[model samples]
Every structure is written in structure tokens, then in C-alpha cells.
Target: MLVYLRLLKESLSFAINALRNNKLRTLLSLLGVTIGIFSIIAVLAAVDSLDRKISKDLSSLDKNTIYLMKYCFGPSEIPQWKREQFPNVKYDEYISLKNSLTNTDQVAYQFFVNKETIKYDSKTVSDVNIVPASNEIVEIEGLNVDNGRFYTESESNSGTAVIVLGYDIAEGLFGGSEPVGKSIRLYGQRFTVIGVIAKQGAGFFGDSNDTSVYIPTNFLRRMYGDNDAMTPVIVLKPVKGVDMDAYKAQVAQKLRAIRGMKAGEMDNFFINVLSGFTDFIDGILGQMNVVGWVISGFSLLVGGFGIANIMFVSVKERTNLIGIQKSLGAKNRFILFQFLFEAVILSVIGGIIGLLLVWGISLALTQLLDFEFVLSLGNILLGTGISAIIGLISGILPAISAANLDPVEAIRTGM
Candidate 1:
């Protein structure tokens, strides 16, 4: 073991010396490896950061939550034309489901509306997201109120002019002052501020509660009647520990009965599960990973070839030294390992440089974009492991050739 360690030390020294002696050649050879590692690790780190952020943003909600709507969240077998013609989920249907569905924990009604502006005196916040939802949305969405309280069921049912401001909206309108009990104008009507949501950072796909305001769904219904362009959806949370498939089946049956669908007729509405949306995200991530690997694989191939070429040249240059070492009782295994270790050391150096670059850029991005970019330990290990494997594959042939040299013939040829 000591002898092998000594060989390793000598090989490292030789590798460094080679780098110093042929600086341009070494740099050129390492460029491919460095770029490859950078491309792969950077892509992976970005994807991982995005995935984590999405999971954190969604952590408060139950994965078993179901969204019943006219349109699906992901791709569906139903034709787009047919989906477009499907009737929207109504408040009455939501009420029926809430009262009849025994397997559900909670049910809420919401309207998907366009961006609108809010006015508090002369201070106007434009293009703010407006969520018109039932009071049950507070429990279903796991909303946190930093001040006052969400509108009560009576307020929602009565279509009272009460609003819950998001963190940013409240700050924009009232600054450091208490926003609750203040009046805000929307759709040319005044509404009393009932609550303010706690601060929530950016969410996946730009959906954040920070710049939003929630009002009673019935208010919107009364303002525009049910024939407006707004899409109404029913959100349902299933009871814990219930069989999800069975629960979903029950939900579909109860909705079918309420909607008066015939036994053989197809259901008009789409049932989108939260877990299914997560699975769709996973699929997208998987595709990105595959593309990254394929593109980076080409760069690694070029790097492997460069290393192999340099190793062959090194063997040729050291023919006489190899012959002398063999004559002085050096074993073939030692000669082979010496060259192999040199290749590995060179590749590992390139990989380490790439990792450093990634770390620096990650820090810069986090600061500049106000988004976290993580470089996890597992990804660093993967980069190192991949580099070592490339080195081993690239060095085998050159090392074998050096180890098999005829001592006298190599000496004569060198001379």
C-alpha cells in the first residue's frame, strides 16, 4: 500500500509538471471537460432549485386536494373544442358537493378572473390579482392572516363588500398604517378591508399571494352575473387516510347526480388532482435532465479524446525513461498506475475548477435575482465521479502501451 501511495504521489507531481511545461496544451485539453461539467452541474442545480421552491410554496396545501373545473390543469384526452363548450362549475354545485360529499374534508368555490386594479383614495395598485372565493377557501388554501380575520361565511353568502388584502397590496395601499377597517375601491364599488394575508414570497410560475386580494365569490357573481368570461372552479380537500381513488369516484358520482348526467353520458367537468400536477412537473424535469446529459455528453467525449491524445504523446516522450525504470526493477503494474493516476488527476482538476465556477455564479445569481440557487453536495460528488470515470476510460490504452514496452527496443528507439 505504501509503495502504491508513493507511486500516486510521484504521478501527481508528474501531472503538475506536465501542466506547467505545456500550459497551452493542458488548458486546451481541459477546456472540453470544464465546459462539460459546468453545463451539466449548472443545469441540474437550476432545476433542483426550481423544484425546491415550488415544493416550498405548495407545502401548505394537501396533495390530495382536487380541482373540479371546465378546463384541465395538464394535457387531457378531451378535445379543446369540447372542453371550451363545457359548462363552468357553479356556486350551487359547490354547495351541493359540500353538503353531500361525506368523504371530503372541505369544499370551496373560486372564480378565475383577469387582473384588476384596487384604489385606496389616490393610491392605486394596478394589475393586481383578485381572488373571489368562498369563506371555505381560508381553510382549503391554508391561508394565514397577519391582521384582522378572513371574511365570515355570512359575509360571503350575503355578498358583503369585504376584502382581504395580500401583503404587498396592503403595504402599497396603507404603508405602515393598519389596513383593516379601511375602505378600498374595486369595480367602481367601495369594499371594507377585513383582513391582510401574511407575506409570501414568489411562487412557482409567478403565482404569488403577495399582490393579490380576496373577496367573496358572490360579490363577483352579483357584479357581473354568472355569464361573464370568468371561470368558476370548485376546490375539494379529501379527508385524511381515505382511499383517494374511492374518494375521487365518490366525488364524480355525486357531481354527476347533481349535474343530472345520464348513466351512459360522459362527465363534462375535469377533475385535476394536485398530485397529478406534481407528476407533470416531474416529467418536465426529467426531460430537461435527459437533454442536459445528451448535450454535455458530447463535450465530455471531446475531453476524453484530448486526454487520450496527450497521454499517448507523454508515453512517446518518456520511452527512454520508461525503459530505464523497467531495467531498474519497476513493475508493469506500477508503470500503468503511474500514467492512469496522471490522467485522473488532470481530469479531477478540471472538474474542481468547473464546480468552483458554478458556486460563484450561483451566489451571484441568488443575490442579483433575489432567488435562491443551491449547489448541493450530491451534485458536486456526481461531477467528481463523472470526471474520474472519464479519466480512467481515456488513460487505459496509453497506460497499457507504456507498460508493455520492450525495454531494449524502447531505449534504442529513444536514442
Candidate 2:
């Protein structure tokens, strides 16, 4: 072990000297490895960051939460024309499910409506997301109220002219003043502000609650009279510890019965589960990973070739030294390991530089974009491991040739 440690030290020193003496050559040879490591690590870091953001955005909601809607969230066997023909989930269905579904924790009715402008005196905020939802949405979505409270079930059922403001919307319209009890105008009607949502930062999707205002779904129904353009969904949260498949089946059966579907007729509505959406995201991330690997693999191949070529040249240049060392009783294993270690050290240096570059850029991006760009420890380890493997594969043949050289023949050839 002591001898091997000494050999490693010598090999590292030799590698450093080679780099210093042949600066341009060494740089050119290592560039491929540096770029390769940078590409792979950067891609991995980006994907990891995206995954984290999605997880953070969805963390508050139960993965078992289900959305019953006319449209599917993911790819579906149902044709687009047929999907378009499916009737929108009505407020009545929401009420029926809320009262009838026994295996549920919470049920919510929500509407997807056109963007509307909101006004407070002279200050107007345009293109704000207007959410018309039942009072139960507050509990289903796990929303936090920074001030005031969400509208009650009575207010929702009565279609009262009351509104709940998101953090940004409240700040924009009311600034630092007390927004609760203040009135805001929407659709040419005045609505008294009843609550304000807590600040929720940027979301993975553009649907963060910060820029939204919520009112009773019945209010929209009353205003528009069941407009065809407005899409309504019934969101369900299943009871904890319940068999999800059984629960979904039960929900489906109930819906089918409520909708009056015949025994053999197909169900019109699509059931989109939160977990399925997450699985879809995972599939997309997996594809991105595969693409990153394929593109970066070419650069790594070139890097390996460059290292191999340099190692062979180094062997040729040091034939006489190898012969002398062999004559002095150095073993073949020592000679092989010496060269192998040198190659690995060189590759690792390049990989480290690449990793540092990635870290710096990631930090810059996080600051510039206000989105966290993560560089996990696992990815760093993966980069280092890949570099070492490349070095070993590239240096093997040259190391073996050097180790197997006949002392007299090597000396004669070098002279």
C-alpha cells in the first residue's frame, strides 16, 4: 500500500509536469472532456430543478385528488371531437357528488372562465385570472388566508357578491391598506372583498394563486346563465387509507348513475388524477434525460480518444525511462498503475473545472431568473465517476503496452 501511494504521488506529479510543459496540447486534449461534463451535468441539474419545482407546487394537494371534467389532462383514447361533445360538469353534479360520495374527504366545484379586469376606484388590474369556485375549494386547494376569510357555503350557495383576492391582486389594487371589506368591480358589478390569500410564489405552471381572484361559482352561473364557453370541473379528494382504485371505481359508478348513462354506454367525462399528471411529468423528464445522454455521449467519446492518443504519445516518449525503471526492479503493475493514475488525474481535473463552471452559472441563473437552479451532490459524484471511467478506458491499452515492454528492446528503440 505504501509503495502504491508513492507510485500515485509520482504519477500525479508527472501528470502535473506534463500539463505545465505542454499547456496548449493538454488543454486541447481536455477540452472535449470539460465540455462533455458541462453538458451532461448542466442538463441533469436543470431537470432536477424542474422536478423539485413541480413537487413544491403540488406538495399542498393530495396526490389522490381527482378532477372530473369534459377534457382529459393527458393523452386519451377518446377522440377530440367526442371529447368536445361531452357535456360540461354542471353545478348540480358537484352538489350531488358532495352529498352522495361517502369515500371522499372534500369536493369542490370550479369554473375556468375568461380573463377579466378588476377595478378598485381608479386603479384597474387587467387580464387577471378570475376563479369562480365553491367555498370548499379553499379546503381542497389547501389555501392559506393572509387576512380575512374565504366566503362561507351560504355565500357560495346564495351567489353573493363577495370576492377573495390573491396576494398580488390585493397588493396591486389595495396596496398596504386594509383590502378586506373594500369593494372591487368586476363585470360591471361591485363585489365586497371578503378575504385575501397568502403569498404563493411562482408556480411550475402559470396558474399560481397570486394573480387570481375567487368568487362563488353560482355567481358566474347567474351572470352568464350556463355559458357553453365556460368549463366547469368537479374536484374530489378521496378519504385517507382508502383503496384508490376502489374509490375511483365507486366515484365513476356514482357519476355514471347521476349522469344517467346506460349500462353499456361509455362514460362521457374524463377522470384526471393528480398522481397521473405527475407520472406524465416524469415521462417527459425521462425523455429529456435520454436526449441529454445521447448528445453528451459524443463529446465524451471524442474526449476518450484524445486522452488515449496522448497516453500513447507519452508512452512512446518515456520508453527509455520505463526500461531503466524495469531494470531497477520496478514491477509491471507499478508501471501500469503509474500511467493509469496520471490519465485519471488529468481527466478528473477537467471534470472538476466543468463542475465549477456549472455551479457558477447555476448561481447566476438563480439570481437572474428568480428560479432556483440546483446542482445536487449526486450529480457531482456522477460527473466525477464518469470522468474516472473515461480515463481508465482510454489509458488501459497504452498502460498495458508500457508495462509489457522488454527492457533491452525498449532501451534500444528509445536510443
Candidate 3:
């Protein structure tokens, strides 16, 4: 064991000396490996940032609340025929679904208005989002009111035209003045501000909560011209002791019947459980992992080719040197191990530099994107392992040639 360690130490020292002697050649050979690793690491950093932000955004919703939408994320668009079927979940349907769920804790529907603007006296603010949803939206969204209360069902049904401002919007509209019960003009319609939502930190894309305005779903519909067929979103919460999977299945059956879906007709509505959303995010990351590996592996291959070419040149230059080593009674295995160790050392150095660069890029991205930087220890290990393997394989032919050189002939001919 001690002998093995000593040999390893000597091999490493020799490899380092060789690299130092030919700095330009060593760096030129390392370029392919560096480029390959850089590509993969950049991708990893970007994907990591995006994943963390999306996860946080999705997690903001109550775990018990299921999101009912027309389509899931990604490229799939909801079919027009399917969207037409649900038009709007009427007051009656909402009540019926809520009543039918024995384990339901809360149920709410959303009405979104994009043209919503808030005006205080002469100053007007755009980028105001208005969501007219049931009071249950507060509970489902884990919203905390800075002051005042979320409007009740009765207030919503009454179409009181009262508005709740997100933190930023409240400040913009009323400044230091108490905003509650104060009137603000929205799309030429006057609304009494009733509450302010507590500040929610920047979302996945660094968007602040202060830009939102809330009103009753009924009020939003009345003010913006309700399309009876417009159901923006449905939030459902299941009670304790109820099986979520079974309950979700039951809920789907009821919704299909309400929407008049036929058997095996492929229901158009989408049900988004928290777990399912998490899985979707993981799936996207998994694909990115594949891409990173393939691209990095290709780069490693090119680097290995560079090493093999270099080793071939070294073998030709040192033909007489190999012959001298053989004449001194060195074994073929020793010569082979020497070249292989040299190749591995070069690859390892390149990999270390590449990893450091990746880490630096990750830190920069985290600051710029305001998202998490996830560095996978597994990926680093995998990259290093592959690079070492490339070194060993690329050295094989050159090592064999070095080991088999004829001492008398090589020394005499200087070839």
C-alpha cells in the first residue's frame, strides 16, 4: 500500500512537471474541456434560479386548495369548446359544489380585470391588477391584511364596489393618508378602498404585490361587463380526514357532470394539485439535466481527442527516452500507468477550473435573478469521474507504443 501511494505521488509530480514545461500546449488542450463544462454549468445555474422562483410562487397557495384552471402550464392551450362549456360558474353552481364537498373548508372563484387603474385626485397609476374573488381568496392565498378586513360574502353579493389595495398600490394612491374608506377612481368608476394587503416580497420574476387591487367577483363582473361563461379560476379546499385523491376524483366527476362532459370524452378542465405542480417542475428540470449531460459529455469527448493527439506527439518526440526507460528494466505496465496518470491530471485540473467558473456564474445569476442557486454535488462528481475516464482511455494507444519501443533500434535511429 505504501509503495502504491509513493508511485501515485511520483506520477502526479511528473504529470505536473510535464504540464509546467509546456504551458501553452496544456492550456490549448484544456480549452475543449473548459468550453464543454461551461456550457452545462451555465444552463444549470439558469434552470436552478427559475425552478426556485416558480416553486415559491406556486407554494404561496394553501396546500389544501386545489387550483381549477382551463389549462396547465407549458405549451398546452385550453380548447375553445371546453372553455365555452364552463363559461362562468354561476352563484348557484358555486354554492352547490361547496355544499356537496363534506370536507371542503373554502371555495372561491376569481374575476380578473386587466384595464383596472387606480386614481387619487389628479395622479393616476397604471399596472394595477384587479381580482374580484370571494373573501375565501384571502384564506386560500394565505393573505395577511395590513389593516381592515377581507370583504365578506354578503358584501361581495351586494356589489358594494369597495376595493382592497396591494401594499404598493395603497402607498401610490393615498401616500401617508389612511386609505381605508377613502375613494379612488378605477376605470372612471369610483370605489371606496377598504383594506391594504400586507407586503409580499418579490415573486419569481421580481414583481411586487403592491400592484394588485382586489374587489368582489360580483362587483368586477358588473363593472366590467360579465360574460356568464367567464370563470377565471376555481379554488377548492378539502377538510381534514378526507382523502384528497378520492375527493379530487369525486370533485372531477361532479365538475364533468356540471359541464355536461360525456364518458371518455377527455374532460377539458384542468385540476392542479400542489403535488402535481411540483412534479411538473421536477420534470422540466429532469429534461434540463439530460441536456446538460449530453452537451458536457460531448465536450469531454473532444477534450479526450485533444489529449490523445498530444500524447501521440509526445510519444514520437520521446521515442529514444522510452527506449532508455525500457533498457533500465521498467515494465510495460509502468509506462502505460505513467501516460494514463498524466492524462488524468490534465483533465482534473481543467475540471476544477471549469467548476469554479460555474460556481461564480451561479452566484452572479442568483443576485441578478433574485432566485436560488442550486449546485448539485452529484453533477460535479459525475463530471470529474467522466473526465478521469477520458484521460485513461485516450492514453491507451500512446502508452502501448511507448512500452513496446525497441531499445537498440530506437536509440540507434533516434526515432
Q: Rate the local accuracy (lDDT) of all candidates.
A: 0.91, 0.92, 0.75
Model 2: CA > 4 A from native: none
lDDT of 1 by residue, 1-415 (tens): 9998999999999999999999999888888888889889988998999899989888888999999998899998888888888889888889988899987888999999999989999899999999999999999889999899999999999899999999999999999999999999999999999899999987776758898899999998898889658989999999899898998899889999998999999889888999999989989998998899999999999999888888898899999999999988898998999999999998888888888999999999999987899999999999998988888889999999999998888888789
Candidate 3 overall Cα lDDT vs. reference? 0.75
Taking the candidates one at a time, how many backbone clashes does each contain?
0, 0, 5
Which 10 successive residues of model 3 have the least lDDT summed? 84-93
lDDT of 2 by residue, 345-392 (tens): 888888888899999999999999879999999999999999889888
Candidate 1 vs candidate 3: the lDDT winner is 1
Q: Between the candidate structures 1 and 2, which one is better when assessed by TM-score?
A: 1
List, residue by residue over 254-324, the lDDT tens digit for candidate 3.
Answer: 88787788999776666777667667778878899789879877887888888887778777777787778
Candidate 2 at 170: error in angstroms?
2.1
Residue ranges of candidate 1 with Cα displaced over 4 Å: none
**CA lDDT for candidate 1:** 0.91
